[model samples]
Target: MSEFRLDERLERDSDFLTKIGLCELRLMKDGRWPWLVLVPQRPDVSEVFDLTPLDQTMLTFETVLVTEALKTVTGATKINTGALGNIVRQLHVHVVARSEGDANWPGPVWGHGTAEPRSTEDTKALAARILDALKP
Candidate 1:
């Protein structure tokens, strides 16, 4: 069997955050919103259903864990979580902190505008805060 590997696109597009349980946590480079992606460390699994029952449950817990952490860190008006694999075939869940009057406002974040990448310092600070929040 092949070992698990992160999708190339995900690697290029996001910054690696701390790992939580069975998932590799990542911060989307776009600073437009407080966004995180959770990718299960499983080989060739392109959907949630592809994971074992145990893995699926762990993923759910991590999703909520990430969502709450992001909400607390960003103080967003709402948190959006989804597993839309339309563009990236790798099975990953997105936990986004949304606010009214943001770049996309009431619409979806996808394709709303060009991504404004975060500064290295800002990204490191944000990642640290999130990792701290994930601690038990």
Candidate 2:
């Protein structure tokens, strides 16, 4: 198999955070919500079923870990997880920390409002917090 390459769209939309198990962790550039994405480092795989059974299991574990970490870091009231590949065909899972009255609230975060890009410093700080949360 070829070396894994992150989709260009994902690369453009998020900042590299850290790697967790079999996935490449990413922080969505949108500041409106504490969102994290997990992209399995597998070439040409565009769906969860595209992964091997072992990889699928590992991805599930990593997704849960990230969901918990995001909730803890953001003190979110609710957590959202999905793998909607409509826009970005690359296989990735989104673990978003949601609050009661956040911009969209009770609704989906996508197509709701403009994404407020995080400043470099802010993004770094958030990434650090996420990394800390992921620590054992």
Clashes (candidate 2): 0
- Runs of candidate 1 with Cα error greater than 4 angstroms are none
| Model 2 lDDT per residue over 6-119, tens place | 999899999998887899999999989989999999998888999999999999999999998988889999999999999888899999999998888999997787889889
Instruction: Compute each candidate's TM-score over C-alphas.
Output: 0.96, 0.95
Query: What shift in Å separates residue 37 of candidate 1 from its native position after superposition?
Result: 0.3
lDDT of 1: 0.91
CA lDDT of each prediction against the hidden true structure: 0.91, 0.92
* Clash list (residue pairs), candidate 1: none
Angstrom error at residue 1, model 2 = 3.6
